[model samples]
Target: MKKSLLFLFGLFSLWSFALINFKGVPVFSIVEAQQKTQPLTGKKVKTEKPVTIKRNAVTTVLPVAQYPLPKGSQWSYLDNGSDQGATGWNQLTFDNSAWAAGAAPLGYGDPVATTISYGPSSTNKYITSYFSRDIQIDLNTIGDEVEFGLRRDDGAIVYVNGVEVFRNNMPAGTVNYLTNSASIVDGADEKRYFTTYLPKSVFQNGVNRVSVEIHNRDQTSSDISFDMYIRDKAPDYVCVEDHIACFTSIAPTSQTPVMIIPQEHRFQMLFKQGTAYMDGSGTVPGNHDFTGYIPSVGATSSALGHLSVNHENNPGGVSIVDIALNQDPANPLWVVNNSRKVDFSNTALVKTERNCSGGVTPWGTIITAEEATTSGDSNGDGYQDVGWLVEINPATASVVNYGNGTHEKLWAMGRMNHENIVVSADGVTAYYGEDGGTHCTYKFVANTPNNFSSGTLYVLKMDLALSNDEPSSATATWVQVPNTTQAERNNVTTAAAALGGTNFNGVEDCEISPIDGKIYFASKGKNRVYRFKDNGTTVSEFETFVGGKSYPITTANGVVTENWADGNDNLAFDDHGNLWVVQDGGLNYIWVVRPNHTQSDPKVMIHSSMPAGSEPTGLTFTPDYKYGFFSVQHPSGSNQAQPDATQSNVIFNASAALVFSNKDFLGQQQNLSTNPVVALNSEIQVYPNPTKGLVTLSLNEEADKNLKIEVYDFLGRKVYAKETQTTGINQKETIDLSGFKGEQLVIIQVETGDTKQIYKVLKKDN
Candidate 1:
């Protein structure tokens, strides 16, 4: 049962991380266009894209309900010092004409609301602050009870119409300027609202004034906070978690992102790009110009990890960083420690330019792809320097230069504006996509398993005609290019076209599924994810797995229309076999397709969204499947810093990688306490694990009446599928692998109503 994908509202509780969606902006708009308003620097700006509305297209929008503050509740605040405190300060007649004014939540230590003119520092800060606001209310149209939704630090006392209505975290009898709060408040708890109710009789008919005195727990406290609102009644309540992901500035040097590490009671600056402070110690400063961060762990159990970041500048390169978790005693929170840059110059890597999205091998190395088709050849090796896949060893910080004296370019891969590469689980086969207007999808089969230096490259020539209006598939044949070296042909694009290679529209990232062992690649121009079936030597089946040219477009006037799903790039998969795709094309969305999803049932969900003009890239998941990492790249530069009242406090379009826990997207909270585990049943067995032709499937228990069997090749294409009644109990059946007689791996899946099982079968002979 497949379901069409729709843009889903982020309905998750606010943890340390907050989700932000900056929709309908393009990355290139930053340089060419400008909003007449203040500087954005990397913020959202709405753009009008030409859309042809189809009467039949219906956009599915998930409505989110929020209990927000009513209009005109913002307060004006003044810092109260020991010298200025007076007995009548809480009264409306108090002379406070010289006090400062700002929007509420007037507090320190949070970026979400307007800060009061006071202490983030001990010197310029005051221990207590006084706030007052006058709101006009009609007594005839009001409820009996008034609810004050308040956020404060340490303690606060509220007075309405010169009467003490409520006091929280304050001493019982007497509260003075010098008195401290009864308890200390730290972290996000400071932003929590402590609701206090009072009778409507306490308010006047018109121009009623409310005052609040906020006192810190102590003078030496690191932060102070306060915010509140008055309502006739508590708002229509709903536990809708619309915002769950946190945000950072587009450029990290300006403001580091604050993240709450999963399973830990703390916050940390996970890592920042495009900054001068190189290492976590702040002692060494290397090029802070790194982007497209891909996190890698050393082993299955290690929290300490390494990051391979792509430098997107034209003269760009890749930087490797070593990162570890540290608990800072000052805050008793987890922070990133000793982030050292792994040097790669001494190796054959003299230069790597315009490095963008790449892949991580099963062997634990980073394959950084250069997203260039034409940059004058820099290596003096005849071929251009920018269209190659440069593999780097994270442990040793060495580039696999193939000993050609320069970081060896895999010229045989036939790159034309190469986007990214994905290797099959079998390791001998690799798939890559081209990010060009008329590019072709290609693959390479290594002569030896896991060895890419020597391989036969083939371009896919579809057996069926292609169209942009609809999703299509064909049994494609591989056309092997003769000259495998750049020195021989000098132009891989021409070499690929010389074969019968069919053209695709803007092929982006090619992702090999860990679950189905098939290849899924995104094409921006075509607006579809193409699925392929790869045996060791060639791609046999090619088709659109999900997505098409026309998708439901949301208009500015909130109208549903038909539009293109433009900018589909950077594909990833979680352990659950859900394909998570990010857009580079201007849609600014992160979409997910479930494992059993079909083309008709577009069960794709818009998992994450960003502000307009920012494209999401480098979507990855940790080996433990605990956190998913992605980045918002090259946002609009106008109005990037000002607080958008509608957005989360942490919302910004800074070029930063965001980390979200698996549970945040999966909507299963208990999984947070435990690591995700993939358990295979030992009860089902496939004999001749590395079978040459045929394999026997045996189940320890009785087979259900109707059994479903499926076989997928390395490229994730279904080669064989059957639904049949099996012998009643402990039945055995033989699956013929003779058709797939090659040195490649095939995934066999058996599903019953109650149980499902998967097996990896290696076909080794004729």
Candidate 2:
């Protein structure tokens, strides 16, 4: 059965990527002709757009009451030969292909998803849960008590014969989280069961089936570690494997994020939990200018959560990455100048012209996907032949290149259009999702398992769950990676088969929550996020985002109308147990989802004006939840001939970096001022101060978007011009400054978007 909730998000004009055909009905709210406020007079300011998204819930069979072993009946979990069902607890390190394939009846990828499960037949067997035909252990041989140890991080249920003996009733993490990303990987699921003190007759003289259902939440998050055995009875059993390891028992690893700065100064809290500081001396330029940053140090999310990006659709400014300084909820955030400005030039990775997606690595590095292959040759080349993942150094502002430094080499992973890279907490596994044809989900086990570049990649055959599909809803089953030519993996047919079926509307963004470690990826066109059970064969669907919030708004005295469509681009968990994501719709806004709502919906962390006037694109949390970064691509779309082009700058009005603190919308801005450079007095020249047509401005070639432009008359009446654009280092702008011409002294100011820009333009005597 299909059940969904509600979520709401607005829009942001960013990324020329993912060609969007808004169906002409681009859901947005035009800034009505209202009176203007300070700094923005006469021009329409796109306000918030109220919208609602449906939360689709996947109805699955809940846990049922289990009975005791029956007389002369078959039980589960037998340790005969061939590694039969319910093999109590065994280290699953070698030959995963065999175990994953052998445990077919137990299920693999979620049955309701388009995931691939390996086993005897597509009809049965998935290695997610191992059900057995019971094994008889001599009760007298027992030390007195029986114990089943487990390290399941998500959900694990055990049953004897058809009777449920043990249940890890850990409720699933709430869905529809908008803010407060949890810090640290989801804890491992290690549990133990015991019956040593029970009467020997509890183990009857017959066999039993040790049926177990283990939900992984997500691949990287699945930590199934346990040892089941009869131990000496009494509290002393703690000495046994069951309760052997506590927080102190587990080996903890320490990590530190990389940050390089040419000049040192105070750090600014962009998002929160961490702070990024830079010396404004000669090293930094403007809002988008910085040598490097000091990342907020803290624990990581419970699972793979986020990716950072910068949108550059300039000239109009539909996207503006806002990094609030205040992250604490109880703390009062005081605004300051902690905002760091960035553009495409200083950071070439953000300016990539090819089809690229971002993912985090096990080593706190950025991994970008090279989705463009030889096929889409814009110049009509025979073959571009370029599809691989690129590594980026966030601390050094550097990109990983080939050993020779001449070309950037791809990682061991094969060439394909990757959607997400869900990294594990222990830095051992990386799950990459390739969307296109038959979708392929690949696992990179760094634990020396299998060969390098060749562990095991499975195709999700969502068709296997047809038995559970309801007549009223659409459903599919999952299977293993189809044994086919590697070429098929790159083609569309294989991707479809691999991801269950070709019935997907459009699958995109994939993320794992930090609190629960559940893997979530969406079929953009389908507007759904699927939660794959650890047993790998089960799947569930949830909905909670579309437009604004779940509630509808009535204009003044008008009736209430609901609009849903929260363009979920990507999602990430923060250090403070919050979910952060960027929405792409006509209404641009950044959203922060709370952890546990009734239906698990995302709370609006910060909702800004619509894209018609501003921008807030994709977001990524820093190592520590202290500071986060967001990309503000173009914000307006008045110039693009084809409004649907992925790289069009139609919604770019102006771009600036916004900083927050304590995760508060009104967080205090950190001191961003560095050692001031020699402010040039007569070096810059901007022309046509009061031209009725077009006006052009030029900078020192190295100056950045810090050059702000504004016009004023003798009476101190300010007129609106346009903010310049940034690329590489310098800044420039050409605006139709015609509307404001009845001025005596054409006072032009040029400075950072915050500080007053210096200007001195003499009015021409017509």
Candidate 3:
């Protein structure tokens, strides 16, 4: 499945003023003052020997302890000079009585409370350390949730009741004492806090053992820090399964063109989200040259009374534009007018980079994401830029500043290679996905609805081992991470890794179901889309909806003929509960899957297709479901655009905005008598007459009835014959003359009962 945001804080230190707050949950401290503290004392469990408790000198700080520290939340340690062979070190039954007892803040570097448990030993170089402790679990009085506050200088893996639960700053796969940690943890001077949450499912009726193994960056590492605190509270909400969706089977249609954007029209729209502001300073109202573009989001409706399009450009900057659209339901087409560029560069988006795909907020705004985690200091903010969720006000055509910096970065939402952001109907809880390998899914809970300025971010950790099945999973846990400032926010990825967030295969676009309130997200690299249940505070019921190795298909020359789609990028939901998915890879196709579709009655359909070398992006619908907007990006140049003879007056290319009328998408047709063809010969036309192998025959709606088509060589040999129905006016049918060798002329005949006609055409060799 996919994973989800939060900010950064200064390194973990004993400074009294360094205290931070989340809603009312104070940042747990290992060096709180006033001496109003207790030792690790609680119901003792079975061990070889009694547990030893240590008391250190306490400092006089402030009254910030909102929740009393849990008993036995501290740990005892042992330094590993070399590889400690596989043993029961993580189990409650493991005999660690011989280990030394020391209060937390146990390491050589940084400010500590009691003792330096390891390191600073020049000769006896220690590379890894071990820690274990036991905490009482009173099922009757304890809550269903547990939160942990940890500080590790390098990396560590945590366990509860002998079960391995979380790992941070560590490599994947089996790890041992000799195994070195991942990259050096980010920060200077002090250990940083890495927080996470665990459900009551990890606990039992009695005493549970908490164990940890801390690994150093290298043998010469000067510091190694480790500390933890735990508390239990009732879960805010629970998830129950309602409906599970599966990727519906779809048949790819050939050359069924919808719309096209030519290279000439690219300048009309802005570049991708971040690329527009590349030079650093450009007035919003000024017109400029544009080469290529990517569309990220599209919104339209009568309530909004206009159309909004998002440009997803990385090298320049992202932008949104407001346009007035005129559509005729009877004609099944629309036109763009009164286009106005949204001022993203002048406002908060001046620093946006790789502003990729995003989702629309319920409050009639767009939540554009900066796909780059490390955008250089674009705004000269001292801090490196990019990697943020920016809110845009479509109505005013500007960034939405909620007292934060321009283009509210939602710094409280943490930083990562953000792919998409979907807010809950309540507007307080938001779900996001990261677009990189081995990333985590996250959720942010605001202090109040529609006010995301301050909130708590949590990373999702699933118990996948509990069930081997890939899809239909219903269990996962959320761990809170710090998100108080921009710098702190930038450390979210590292914090989430430490919190044991599940590794996903490049999580992308996330959307919430209005019918069921479930959140759906895509793992593009894995070729699967997944959904989960969110209860505002905590989320559960994570499972894959569809797409995997099981759905087999192949792409040749920008065309896919299979009944499945891969590389699912953006997603949109129409009022009818139909999910429209936009593909990213070469075979740019838009697939529509019905919510209640089943195997016996498959309801998946190919809604549209982008031209060769392009992908359909920014799929969205108006509030009234009357019109849907999308963009076709990056059409290849050397190759011919090769318009579908079936579509009328369409140009598909880079950074082009297009729309589909709800009626046209539903296969509805206008009154045939209103626009009829009197003579078949006069209404029919052939394109590129002297063609190589392929040629198109465009027919008007009068040819809607079954017609017999035949082709003959110069020698009077019948080469081909077929009967088919015309879909609409200007319907195109491609005929291949490749098999007719040594032929310079061919006879083509069309016959439908009383109407029969023959025409001579020239065939050329490649």
Candidate 4:
């Protein structure tokens, strides 16, 4: 009977697993079960036929629906320079049977589907041209909101079902056939399509009429074009886990540009250029580039931190902002609390120029790289001081002040077209690269740990010959440069080159791999990323990690092809040790190279594509690795606007800072032990499993014993450990894991005297 019950239980479990449903229908079902009994022996036997279930078709309803009046559709047009008084011509009831018919766009002076006469002479053209189309709509098939994408040169007035809808570029009040456009159509705006929404109530159930009149800025405007498309107003994109694969690049248009991210990730625009600071210091500056996030002291909230943003302008400044995270699950957003700009007027280095890519030190300070160099000695210190690393205290939102009138500039590090710097975990060793022309990679070792005021600077010198045309490998060494005096430091670049420093082309960024502690940097001019094991005084296994060769890339349409031309620029590493390369010159694609990728067969994937006229800069991840921050610099103003994951309208037509993460993978909480009750002793409990930063441990039962708490990462690396005495019946302890990188699994071991228990916990970013 026990054996029979066990078999029945197995059948029940299988049935339970098969009952899981998608869209209210069971994905699979078990069928054909039989039981036979032996009468003489009074025994029962069971047998089942092979189970088969039909997979049901699942349908998806898109948020938007296009109307029949798509762009390039045939239209009835009148361009004979004849004036039909406004009323009769725009009404659906008025029939123009004699009007010439042609497929849009219909105009002159530019490419069009059908060329129309521009009046009698080239200098005296028609002022107005009328076009109309009939569209069929099913009320049940579309939403109540309707939108129109209209492209026109000079000016236009659109009417739907004889009702005036919208007017563009034309003066207010009454308009006639001879009315001129308010402004001349020129450059990109002339060919750009403007979008507007209207009520679906303007149309009947079946046939609807859309009429448009195009008017030139002047009688002899020299050009006129018009084209339009209509669709139900709804969201064009949705972020769903495993549902969408990727977002492709878009061209410059009047519409807003959308960010290209993995389909599963959710993107939010935290701040934009020109945003007013809460402190009233000033609005956020433009030409945004580098972004560094510094977690606040004892901060448990994922959103609460200091964010430093670099302005890459002639007179650049770093903006420090205080941010907080919203806890509402339905509307998770990072809120900017306050902001202020770093002051530099009082220091020897009166001002900073072209503040570009920078790094956050291990000891919680921001070091902004001054990318532009000047020959003038403004401080009269016998050395040019414009191009140097300036340290800022984010908490104070000002430059770190030394004694006298001097400020935060690291004079010993030398000057060049400094792109970015990366400090090692020890905070003593730093690596940086130059950004323009023929530059060299350099390293600096602080005389004392965590202090950059004094350091021994060295330039990289490789043994093997380096070439820009092909992949190169070599063993390298860091050769010391003469930096004992200010003049020597100012001319460090020249001295380094004299010491046989390998002249790498445009080294844009440098980063340290979390998995292996190797140094990686991007040579934008050479189109490659190189990695080397920094063995203190020497380097080993120096080779190109990615780029400089053809690698397979999957296009948005699912076609795989080889792409050899990539101008790799910025570099970042995720918790999983994947190197993310953001391109600046070629295709502007963000590529992800796996940790185990080999030079012979590089394992790379196209993660994202930037919009036209824009380059991605400053890619950095939070400690939990659940979120990342980056900037879209100098995108075309004509890029279209799109709705973000929260249904908020966002436009990337200008420089902006954005954050993104995988939606489904965010805010997940787990305990360390397989069974919390057994391992935690029932009396011990951990609250707020998926913590923003702070975690609390509570003990309810009475116990007088020595308690030890420890945390270990997946790699068995001890990240945190603490010990205390439990003197009372109830005890509580708070653990701060805000500084850990990426959303990761860590084991927590709790020991009370001879009894020890382990629990698995998931640390996340919000």
**Best candidate per TM-score, number?**
4
lDDT-better candidate, 2 vs 3: 3
Show where candidate 3 strays beyond 4 Å. 1-306, 325-333, 344-350, 375-383, 404-407, 465-473, 536-538, 549-565, 598-603, 638-648, 662-766
Per-residue accuracy of model 3 over 1-766 as CA lDDT, tens digit each? 1211121232233232322222232433322321223222222321122223322321221121223233222365766464554777778777665455544556675434334445556644577888777666666765567667566768888888678788878899987777888878643313334557677778676767778888888776766777666665322211111111112233454433333322111111222222233223442221111111112243324422444554555443434443443344343333333345555555234556666776666666777777787656666664456777877665555677886444556778877888787788778888888887336788888997887778999988763321122421244668888777776777888888887887776777778876567788877766666777765444554555555422222222333435454677887775545677777773567766666432222345555556566677777655545445666666544334343222433344344655444333222245645533225667677767887778788877554677778876643346788998756686888899887666487767776555666666888876
Residues 241-353, model 2: lDDT tens digits:
11101001111111111111111111232322113423231221111211112232323441122223322212101111222233444333323333332222322223332
Candidate 1 per-residue lDDT over residues 1-766, each given as its tens digit: 1222221211221111212221343322322232212121122322231111111111111111112233213454565465434566556566443344433445665442344545445654576788776567677777677777666788988887667888988889976777788898764346445566677888777666678888888867767767675666522211111112211111111112322122221112244454443544333222222223334553463245666666565655565666543333222212344344434443234466567778878777788776775566644656665567777777666676666655665666655677788887778888887777337788878888876888887778764335332322224567786655566435667777777677777778888777657888888876778786666554544556677633332222342333326777888886557687777765566666666554432344455555444566777665655445566665544424432111224433445544554233322223322322112265567889888888998765554456788887754556778887656556787899988755987878887654566677889985
* TM-score for candidate 4: 0.56
Task: Write candidate 4's Cα lDDT for 79-175 as tens digits.
Answer: 7888876547767677654455554556777655457778888888889999877677788877677767677888999987788899988899998
Could you tell me every candidate's TM-score relative to the true structure? 0.48, 0.39, 0.48, 0.56
* Model 4 misplaced stretches (Cα beyond 4 Å): 1-256, 299-301, 403-405, 468-473, 554-559, 562-564, 665-766
**CA-lDDT, candidates in order:** 0.57, 0.35, 0.57, 0.71
CA lDDT of 421 in candidate 2? Answer: 63
Instruction: Give the best candidate by lDDT.
Output: 4
lDDT of 1 at 739: 85
The CA lDDT at 401 in model 4 is 71
**Model 2 lDDT at residue 526:** 40
Of models 1 and 4, which has the larger lDDT?
Answer: 4
